[model samples]
Target chain A: MKLTVLYFAWVRERIGLPRETIETDAATVADLVEELRGREPRYELAFADLSALRVAVDQELADFDAPVRDVTEIAFFPPMTGG
Target chain B: MAVRVQQEDFDFGAEADAFAEGRADAGAVVTFTGLVRDRPDGGLREMEIEHYPAMTERAIAAIEAEAVSRWNLVDSLILHRYGRLRPGARIMMVATAAPHRADAFAAAEFLMDYLKSRAPFWKKEVTDAGAEWVAAQAEDEAALGRW
Candidate 1:
């Protein structure tokens, strides 16, 4: 499946891009993270601490265990500091 | 009820009046505005707020719905701004209306609490020294436990 992955805040800064299109067979968000981590050192560093990050699948908040199959977009960022 | 995420600033007085207009049953209206504050040293030049456009509206809508249900609110409005803002600029505002003061106040606080930690907006402060992202506070997350 083709997925459009997005990064925000420091996650985007660390990864050096705001968004990317990935063709992968990973079935879950955790799996996709591992796949991306293997593709480059930047991914490894940015995702080094999953506890510091939050994710959304198809624009809705979801956990790392959330399945990625049949999903079109995934966004990764730090805990929000909004008001 | 309305939830709006925009890049432009809003008028607080006009919005407040409109929110309460024609709602004779509503005896109380509460509002909270968040502004960009400079550091104590006063070197802060600007604040750039970034948000997930696709999700911001939906997330705030869900929050508004919850507040309305919990407090039996007559109406509510949430306006959050993004992009560049100078110090003292308004960043966001939340207004709530209910039949009584307690429900209006509590619901407004609840909206602010959830909006602070749950909404997908992030703030980056740029100063004469450098640019830095605002870190999320542990206290903000813990505040959710009360609700």
Candidate 2:
């Protein structure tokens, strides 16, 4: 499936990119993350610590185990602190 | 109920007037305007806010729905702005109208707490030294637990 991924805050800083479109065979959010992590050293470093990062599927807050099949987008970022 | 997420500034007086305009049943109106403070913890010079477009709106809508379910509110309005904002600029607003002050006040506070803790928006502060990402405050999480 084709998916647009977004990174924000420190995650964006570490990754050096804000958004990208990727085609992957992953079925879950965690799976997709691992796919990205394998593509480059930067991805590995950016996703080194999953606990500090948060994921959202199609713009709704989601867990790492959430299914990603047919998802149009998946965003990864640090925990929010905005009010 | 009205929810607005925009880049432009909003007029509180005008918004409040429109909210209470033809609603005679609304005996009490409580509004809270959150401005960009100099420092949330006395450790900042400038702040940058970033948010997920779809998630931000979904989260706010869910919070508003919760307020409506919990309070006997006649109407409610929520306005939040995105993009770079400087200090003293309005960040958000929550206005609730009900038949009594108690419900209006409680609902307004509840909505603010929810937005602060649950909304998926990240804030980074830039000081003279460097920039640092802000983390969710324990106080905010604790406030949400009270509900």
lDDT scores of the candidates, listed in order:
0.94, 0.86
Prediction-by-prediction clash tally: 0, 0
Model 1, B1-147: lDDT tens digits are 899999999998898888888989899989999999999999899999999999999999988888888997888999999999999999999999899999999999999999999999999999988899999999999999999
Give a tens-digit lDDT track for model 2, residues B1-147. Answer: 888888788998898888888889989999999887777566667667887777788888989999999999999998888777777888888999999999999999999988886787788777777888888777987998889
Residue B56 CA displacement from its true place in model 2, Å: 2.1
| CAPRI quality band, candidate 2 | medium
DockQ of each: 0.91, 0.70
lDDT of 2 at B102: 99
Error of 1 at B119 (Å): 0.7
Q: DockQ score for model 1, please?
A: 0.91
How does candidate 2 score on lDDT? Answer: 0.86
Please provide TM-scores, in order, for all candidate models, with all chains considered together: 0.98, 0.90
